[model samples]
Target: MLRPMGREDMRAGDSDRKTVADQLKTALDEGRLDLSEYDDRLQRTYAAKTYADLDGLLTDLPGTVPVQRAQVQPHTPAAAPAPQTASPARQIAQWAGPYGAVIVVCVLIWAITSASAGHLTYFWPVWMLIPLVFGVCGQWFGKGGPHRR
Candidate 1:
């Protein structure tokens, strides 16, 4: 019969080393270890050959429970509720709000310039408005539009 696996003699892998490295990084971020100490521990973590070695590095830290086999639970089936689609008006409002703000700001600048410069010049804001209008229209009518959701 096969025996249960034990942690002490388990071989450490690259992912295990990376997990330890990430924990060390978090500790360094939280002021638990200085740069030099963190660097030293990180190097040792990558060099660790077995689970025991990895466990030793984290022994002083809180919440570092040794890895164990996950307990399996019985599976059950329950249908999840379907996601509700946004109303066409809601989607239009969402897409329009930012674009509307950009158009407004551009028009305000153009108007202020025209007033200062004695007369209305080229309707330069139309350049900004055209592409935004096209995008909004595309989003409203395209195959991948929000309404399709």
Candidate 2:
């Protein structure tokens, strides 16, 4: 049996239930609760038919998320055309465009040596031109490159 104080607490709990029922009814009347939600809540509150049942009616609803996920995924942007880049161009452009003096030197070495000896091997430095083109194109098409946040 509950103590006298426990009896008082039980009465208070009953009063709280009445308050909740009244609030739910008011929400239904005021059109705050949709017809479906109001009907569902009413079913719970009334069909419970006992203290334990009523207590179980409002289960795990407050402050609960709809779904659970171990980790949030980083938003990857949609795929683009084959040539589009995900990074800005100014960076590599600096090395390929403004700092392309090294390419010029290599070319000169290959040019001066090609006529005298075959060791100039201009093809070695030719590979640098690929990245250079990419950097320049990046500067052109990279206008809105890479997503912001």
Candidate 3:
């Protein structure tokens, strides 16, 4: 009985050659292969007759798909990622850092501008602090507040 043709043994077509040529061009662009090696690989890729032949050309190049490698493998469901829930204190702390940074940066900008022109600039950054205060109040006094049993 004649054995069935395996994937590697299958004859490559023009499209297959074109795909390999594109991959080789990418390898050249990434500096993985110098101009001489790229030219050699490009020539060999066009001259390739089978998938196995094409596979050898890109075996050492990074990020190029192996021509003979199986496209699909046995599927196994991956474990789901764990959900994240932070405690009130942790949530408050997380909220504080970013807001504090914004406040500090704004205050610095205000001071610098004030000094630059010869007097204190208006403290406009106080407006930015309103959201931070409300966020903290919600975390402490809202339905999910820490004090609720």
- For lDDT, the strongest prediction is 3
lDDT per residue for candidate 1 within 1-149, as digits (tens), equals 98987786789999999999999998888888899999999999999988888877866776565565346579998999997877656767787888889989999999999999999988898998787778768767875476574
- Candidate 2, residues 1-149, lDDT tens digits: the string is 95564322332255556655666677767767778997888667755444545554334344222222225679999987696444465455555655498788878777887867855454677886887787666665665455432
Ordering by TM-score: 1, 3, 2
TM-score of each: 0.65, 0.30, 0.45
RMSD to the true structure for each prediction, in A, is 4.7, 19.3, 6.6
lDDT scores of the candidates, listed in order: 0.83, 0.60, 0.86
Instruction: Give the distance in Å from residue 53's predicted Cα in candidate 2 to where it truly belongs.
Output: 58
lDDT of 2: 0.60
TM-score-better candidate, 1 vs 3: 1
Error of 3 at 122 (Å): 56
* Model 2 alpha-carbon drift over 4 Å, by segment: 1-95, 118-122, 144-149
lDDT measured at residue 142 in model 3 versus the true structure, 0 to 100: 79
lDDT of 3 by residue, 31-131 (tens): 89899999998999999998888888878987765744548678999998897866777878887888899899999999999999898778899999999
Model 1, global lDDT:
0.83
The lowest-lDDT stretch of 10 consecutive residues in candidate 2 is 61-70
